[model samples]
Target chain A: MDYIRVILTIFWKDILAERRTREILSAMLVFALVVILLFVFAFDLSPETRRNTAAGVIWVTLCFSGTIGLNRTLSVEKDRGGIDGLMLAPADRTALFFGKALTNWVYMLLTALFVVPIYSLFNNTNLFSFTLLGVIMLGTFGYIVTGTLLSSLSLQLRSREMLLPVLLFPVVIPLLLSAIRATSILLEGGSQTELNTWLVLLFSYDLIFLAISVMVFDKIIED
Target chain B: MRNSTKTSLMLIVVDILAASLILTALFMVFYYAPVEVEMGLVQKIFYFHVAAAWTGMLGFLVALAAGIGLLRSGNMKWDIAGVAGVEIGLVFISLSTIMGSIWARPIWNTWWTWDPRLSTALIMMLIYFAYLLLRNGVEEPGRRARFSAVYAIVGFVSVPLTFLSIRLFRTIHPVIIGSSDPAATGVFEMSTRMTHTFMISLVAFSVLFVALFWHRVRLGVKLALFEQRKMEDFTGED
Candidate 1:
């Protein structure tokens, strides 16, 4: 009960903060739109090629633009001294970790919400199937889980703005790989076993890293 | 303070062992190992190529273990061990990658393929490069050690998935010395001499890894001591 409250409190605070500014969400959305256009021009997508490349475009756009939001997730808190205040509060720190991850996860999901429809509109392909949306949710969870944890670590470093993606990208490659392949499978109506395997991969990835991040978040947050 | 005792007796022994073992392995690879009927001369590169990949994997494993050590014990020496492991791992992995690329040019008809193994190797290098950069970004020793250990653990978690993902994803890399995949290319059957040469090469590279790892750890110790002294210098007389 207490843990949930602390988490919700932070979540609410972040929501309020983001609502007031909407800076992170707007940046992510605009960047995602540009990436979609860039992909269309770069790949010279035909209807056939568009279906093949849509997964890559959607995932890459979310991956890159979400990075912009993730970089700010922690740095904004630290920059405003909110991190120190939260840490000093007599609340469970792991709860705070969850709250921040939850907020970022929501931001990424929202970004996908916008990007997926817009990508469909631009590419003139339907990408909003139930299974594809599920993949998006699973993939975004894994991505934000990692992005938030790593942003916490990177935020305290020198030249942190430039350092976040370098630190985060390698770690998330497997997730992206699975996500992209799974998206392709969904879009192309690939075999069930193939989809199951990538789903299992994404689920296991989310589980393992989530547990590891929770266990180690203490060490990272301790001043 | 510089290293005392001029040369450690153990280092001299390691140097001699590594040199002799590597030379013998090279001789075995070139002169002893029977050339495969199919890839001919280029097949010889397979020996050192495997050896270098083995050593590279060994280096990252050392870093991973050392990371666990640091997290559990909170010791600076563990950080030194971790740094030494990653630096050596990055260099040898790059070498292995180059060798693989060279082999691919002849065998696979391209200098590179978007194969899982190749991409994984490249990604591993990027992860460790980030590891080194992360360590360099922090001036405080404790924070640097803790953060890098965390990153190492996180980075290593992705490696096996590259292998696992390949099951659903097709690859053209040769399925050498393991379960046969008909889809694989560059297949070879190792004859008796090839087997012996391969074994010796593996052993020799293991020895070389140990020698280089130890040397790096020693240098790391000296650097830490030097840094400590420099820090002490900044404060006029405590």
Candidate 2:
């Protein structure tokens, strides 16, 4: 119960901070929008082509934007000594992990929330599909889970900003690949049978990585 | 002193054993192991190639375990061992990847395929190579150990994911080279003589892993001791 409060409190603090400053979200949003625009020009795809490739474009953009958001979010805590205070509090390290992950998830999702409507308007496509949202949610969950833990680990280092991607991208490639493929299938109006295997693969990936992160996270933060 | 003597004696025995094992494995592979209907002579490289990869993974797992042990106990010696294991693992991974490439040239006709195992091996190599770089980037001994330990632990998870990530793209891929059942790969058949040779080679490689690990650990201890002495000298505390 206390752990829940701690997590919520941390989450709220992060939310309030972002609301006041709008640093992370603004950067992420602009970056994502730019990436989408670049994809539009570079690929020169028709509507059908864009729809098919939209999943990949969105995910690649999210991954890049997500990394930026995570770095800024953690940097905020580290810079303001907020994380130190949080650590000093009577909260479990897992709570901190969860709190940060949740906050980052919301930020990422919010970025998506803002991104999708604009994407639909600009591309003149329907990204408002419930299935696409489902893919984004599931995909973002795995990304934030792994990304938050790695950001924490990297925060304690000197070349932290650069180190996070180096440590993360290789490990997280499976998530990106699975999410993109699943999303692409859905966007193409594929039947459930066509998407079933990828959905299972995505869920299993999220579960396996979440479990491993939970097991090792204590060691990571024990300093 | 006594430990060094024993280690040196063990090294001699291990050297002899490894030589005999490699030769016997080679002999059996060429003379006894049946040629594959599909891959022919190139399939022979799979034995040594996969053996190298397996040993590399074994070394990586050991490094991860040692990393956890060091953190739990706060022992620098365990940290030293962890670094040594990762370095040796890096070497073996490189050997395996190169051998895989060599074999791929004749078999896959491209000298490379983005095959899952090969791709994963490449990722493992980069992760650990980055592990070493991360260490070099830090100046503090304590912080270096902590960071490297975390990196090693995190890096191991990628090994499996990299090896299998392609399967999510499609399940048409076969994990024949490292499967538990030989028939699954359908590319190679091992006679009894071949099996004997493989066992010998496995044992030999395991010994080599230990010897190399021990030597690296000794170097780490010596370096640490030297630092300690230099610090003491600087402070004039001795």
Candidate 3:
């Protein structure tokens, strides 16, 4: 279908652009690493404490670094007048939203993939587990879905850099809380019953925001 | 001019009604409701605390409705109502949080705890604060309204999920009048007079919310009109 092609075209365009420059990914990765290092010194945890706090540290890092990627990606589009170009394309606006959100999700996942290994190395906790990965995927999906939508709005603002997180963090609390709980449980070998609720919460949040952002995308991007 | 006078008259009538009801509710809370035996006078904050919180929720619902209105109709009046609701809601939520904290110190032995309701309310406050900030950062009127309405709807949709996640994860806040939760800490029985006072206070606060919302909307209308007139004058000169 033309819609599918449109979405993929946008996705591939971002991939090609990133492959060329590596600007957004590099900034996100570096910022993520710095946050982890800062947390390491700030907490100064023992092995036992590290095991308990590792989930918190990873999420906090992702959240802060994720903001960098989101702000930069959207602002680039705005800066180059790429959004106007996309608008003039012969495609449904929702397809454009999907394309951007999918690319954003890939960026977030890639950041998490890089962060997890480095985090495990630093903390001596093997975070490369199936369960933790699942939570990270769901959390990152919800985060980027909402973040991409908000960043589009924020990019048009006078204080785009500061405005994104202010608009984002609070709305993303449920997703973050659920992710943290599930991650902590997996790390600590907690019972399955305890983890199930948080997983469900994450799924519900993803569904709700995904549907909302899709429906409202056309409205916000209207010239 | 006729419409303005009519609106002013209606506002005056609503103002008197809100004022008298609030005063009567205060009288009932202080005089009619029996002093809570265990928490003593500190428990009196409960009537106003709960009332302010109800008003806050009401204000948010107004914003939600106004958000939908704006999206459906593309009218600036809906945008005005949306902003007015959020501003008033912010004030009342702040009041409720402060008063709840004041009540919590004696009851919970801590200034604050991560009780599900308290935490969700805090997050709600932050979200709306960001809403106001988002509105402030935009320059163009139409674009600002469109962006803000979308954000308001998005933010409103997230609130229930936020509350649900917190409530399911951990809950120590009391369910005052409803479900029986053995784990809830602050549960207390209300006497008949206390119930009466609570109900009256809720009604009074709802009326106050309406009056304040209408006043705020009028202010927004006046602001928009002044800006429009100024722009017209400048354009005419050109």
User: Per-candidate DockQ versus the true complex?
Assistant: 0.83, 0.50, 0.86
Most accurate candidate by TM-score: 3
Better of 1 and 3 by TM-score: 3
Candidate 1 vs candidate 3: the lDDT winner is: 3
TM-score for candidate 1, please give it.
0.95
- Clashing pairs in model 1, backbone N/Cα/C closer than 3 A: none
lDDT (10s digit) by residue, model 1, range B1-238? 2454445677879978999999999999888988889898898989888889878877888888998899888989999999999999889888988998898888999998888778877888899999999998999888998999899888888556544434545677775666545677898988889989999999998999989998999999999998888888877475
Query: Which 10 consecutive positions of candidate 3 chain B have the poorest summed lDDT?
Result: B161-170
Clashes of each: 0, 0, 0
Task: In model 3, state the lDDT of residue B173.
Answer: 68
The CA root-mean-square deviation of candidate 1, after full C-alpha superposition on the true structure, stands at: 2.1
**Model 3, residue B109: what's the lDDT?**
83
lDDT, candidate 2, equals 0.78
Tell me the deviation in Å of residue A87 in model 3.
0.8
Residue B7's C-alpha lDDT in candidate 2?
A: 77
- Between candidates 2 and 3, the one scoring higher on lDDT is 3
lDDT of 1 by residue, A71-178 (tens): 887788888988888898788888889989998889899999999899888766678988888999999998988888899898889888789999998899888989
lDDT of 2 at A114: 80
